[model samples]
Target: MRSSAVWRALPRGDLLLTSWPWRSLAYLITGVLLGEVVLLTFLATLFTGAILATVLVGIPLLLALALGGIPVAALERRRLMIIDPEPVENPHRRPERPGAREWLLLRVREQATWRELAYLVLLVVLLWPVELLAVVFGLGAPMSMILTPVLRAQTGDVRVLKFWLVTSDAEAFAALAVGAVWLALALYPLTLLAAAHGTLARAFLAPRESETGQRLAEITRSRTRLVEAFEAERRRIERDLHDGAQQRLVALTMTLGMAKLTEGAETAELVGRAHEQAKLALAEIRDLIRGIHPQILTDRGLPAAVADLADRSPIPAEVSVALPRRLPEAVEYVAYFVVSEALANVAKHSGATRAAVTGRLDGDLLVMEISDDGVGGADPSTGTGLAGLADRVSVVNGKLMISSPVGRFTLLRVEIPCAPTDHSK
Candidate 1:
């Protein structure tokens, strides 16, 4: 908020008393200096590169001349922060590799490079002169007039700058009064001019207009990476529980069974109880492994997995899936889980005795819908797990829609863009 533009902060008052006028003056002075430097350097580079073209030694120089705007624009962006407190964003993308060749290749192809070059040309030919004129007319002339009494006191009734002749104390004081008024009025226009220059600089030097799209793309890729890592970790946990803990529990159960057979009646009941406990723990571990990731989903694909879910649900359910081939692994995983969560919601809250699931591959999108007839008023916002399901779907750029009205049917639909991995019939 403190970094808002100078013009925006103008309404806060103390215009003449504040540091803004001084800051504007400084901005103009620097602009003139930078404009001269850019003009001379670019002219020399272009003319020299043109003169030595037949020898082929000037090719690199020509290329360097084209990229000269990059540094000029960078310096101007820094300079702009003097008048406009908001920092300008550099639009250039980083190179894929660490070499100069990679940097130039990327810069040359970018639209920001050309826009910056155009700004540099305007700076040299047009903008700096306008800035200089505004400063001279707006500040210089008024200050000169305000010094009329001082000038008249030093010289006897003399002409000031050969423009206004001040003959006496009254005339000199009158000229000073006019100058004071002019300076007061001039400061506002001067500040506005400086602010306008800053706006122009920012338009060219800042980030491209597509910044929102760029950020969304970055977030999407980041979420995809996180999803992949999460899936891998789930598999790792499942593998560890199956290979390590489940094996030990199995051996414990077998030992307890043998002891029950060989020991006397007194020890037999104790052995049997221990064996039962081991069996229960083993079953719980197996269920945890299934919950983490089902083997059927991996082996038989999404359709068979959904059918398995239907069979396991407490309520009777119907499922229809028509995929000629297997979808991408991530797509299938998200789709399967969405169905699983929706059905769980149906069983727990919908109070419906029956539910239906339908799925199909529609072009590049895999569409699935789960519906139930119940006293339905499901709100995803009320911690019904639909909110988390929506987030999971968005990880793969998918969409989830819920149509649940009070005292009616609840329908959950999801669509994700994906293609079948194996096309062989």
Candidate 2:
């Protein structure tokens, strides 16, 4: 993997042959040009807006000037890619809704907006000119000297950068050799300066450390919401199937059974078959409801749910969960499914005679492990089921670890950080 910073990407002892030095020079040159433009535009708009403030015409102009850094910083970010291949994330958060008022309000309120403005001010007043000078002296002078031989041949007598006269080919070639040496030495500082400039831009323009953390927190919260929503929808479907379809199927089965008992010998067999089909349909619906979101898991929590799974597993399974109380619904749901799937995998593939599931709340973490004594090689890549389970665990900021060495026991472990629910509730 490539390092995000260009300085880190630079190969040691190969400055001349690599593209980094050229990229640095280009980055500096562009910064200089961009800075000059920003400075001129800034002054023009700022003073004009100030002068016209009383007239009401300048109000919009001032607002524009205030938010001007957004576009400027956006350009800078794009330019930053030249020297720093690392992505510079914009610190600004999206508005909750799309509207000019919301956008401007959010921008004005955000610390990132003000930070960008400060960066623009710094760039206009100080940084860009410094970069300009460095590029001119560091890269420009050496390049000019390297062209010494060409200049002397063209003019027969040429003043080298107006510093010295070079009339002879020998003198020009000597200057060329010196310039080559100078260029090699100059590239180091050039790269360093560009790297520094990129770092400075990043400091003000990129998201702050706290902001990054906040974004991560927001993402976690949003993911949790999505998971909650998904679970609720599943439960809704389960309720519909259990109450509506299952009730109708049960009534049909009872009616057919009664018909079989009451009917003559000619119709008895037909009614019996119809009654059996209704019962099967009713059973299947119940299974579908359980698969969607088991009511037992909801009512009795994880311990009982694991026990239920153990009782149903084709392979002999033991459950030992030491939770004294219920956990959050999402946590219980995820844990239950992980154990259920692990046992299913064991029964189907592991040839395991016995499987054990253990769960306990250790500190804030809900820890669950499933182990099977069988020929063991569990690879999530071979099937989507395990991969999907892993994703489900991650949605709650949990981790899934699978240790299934070939010809050994397969152990699947999961840890989720959450405060246990108050059983009193």
Candidate 3:
């Protein structure tokens, strides 16, 4: 009878404890530690912000570093998906050359910055209070212990302020029971647990309106980078022309002029050298144009595009191409680039007997896979190759996955949403 009465009068936690008797210990530990975990998470964000600020300097470096957060913020969102047990959506992608200065400047200048900032701000707001409380809860009790002696003496009597409700010696003893609800602010442990859960949900679980904006921003940024890459490549080609073909042409023209001043075997040799230089210059020009846009791709679409690729490989390429008619230009362009880059990686890195490129249109997606049976250990983090592929996929609102374990085949897969027909039209 006493045990039952004791249980009944116990704080609500006793009922909860009995229900999860097996997990009660674990729950207590987690509950007590919750606030500390929240505190650490908030500190991590502040640390990241500080790190970015400290590392960034000047206009270019600062802009570049700030834009770098787009990817990290996107990663943070993905982490939330797994931890929050909610759907993980796409992450933010910003231009390699995103505009703006401070967050306020960038928020007005670039939507992606605003989106990324909103996510960070919301996450911090959600975390800071929880973290602060958790820190307070975890530490406050001990701090309170230090003050208890002083508080006791100041009162002159051990008077319980409203704790007088425990009129009976038994009730007062019960209320002050060690490790029980009647003990010092015993309600706090439960409050701390709920706060921790809410903090985790806010920081890592819940997807927000900003996630959608981030996805759009990533696409926009990737597109801008790709265009910038194209321009940069063009500039490189122009530089090569000025240095190689242009110089060669000038030398060839000068040699022909010199040949006119002589008429012997040496003059004949001079004309031959000029002719050879002209051929070399022509070859360089072809290579430069190919870099701009493989003319075959523009003329005959992807099959011929990849065929030109396969035909040139030192190691033979087995190519398989399929499509459901044609796709929207946006999807097709990304699909082509993904295949091109994947093949380039295979040719450069993969020690394969043979390679294959496959393309097919599935539902509203243009799915393409390029594979090579090679000495493999392909990781996304290993190089800029897969990162570039990811950016390409991002630009087209697509996904890219790479699988390569040691001694297995390396496969690069790309999927981009495509429409066979436009509804708005």
Alpha-carbon local distance difference test for all models: 0.81, 0.83, 0.60
Off by over 4 Å in 2: 1-4, 7-11, 50-54, 152-156, 251-425
Flag the better candidate by TM-score, 1 or 2: 2
Better of 1 and 3 by lDDT: 1
Model 2 has an lDDT value of: 0.83
- How many clashes does each candidate structure show, in the order listed? 0, 0, 5
| Residues 98-135 of candidate 3: C-alpha lDDT, one tens digit per residue | 12333335344655555555545444455445545554
- Give the lDDT of residue 148 in candidate 3: 40
Model 1 lDDT tens row, 236-297: 78787777677767767776767756757757766766767677777777777677678898
For 95-116, candidate 2 gives per-residue lDDT tens digits of: 5433577678989889989888
What TM value does model 2 have? 0.59
Top model number, TM-score: 2
Off by over 4 Å in 1: 1-4, 9-14, 147-159, 165-177, 230-425
**Candidate 1: residue pairs that collide:** none
* Candidates in order: C-alpha RMSD to true structure: 20.1, 20.3, 21.0
Q: Over the full model, what C-alpha lDDT does candidate 3 score relative to the true structure?
A: 0.60
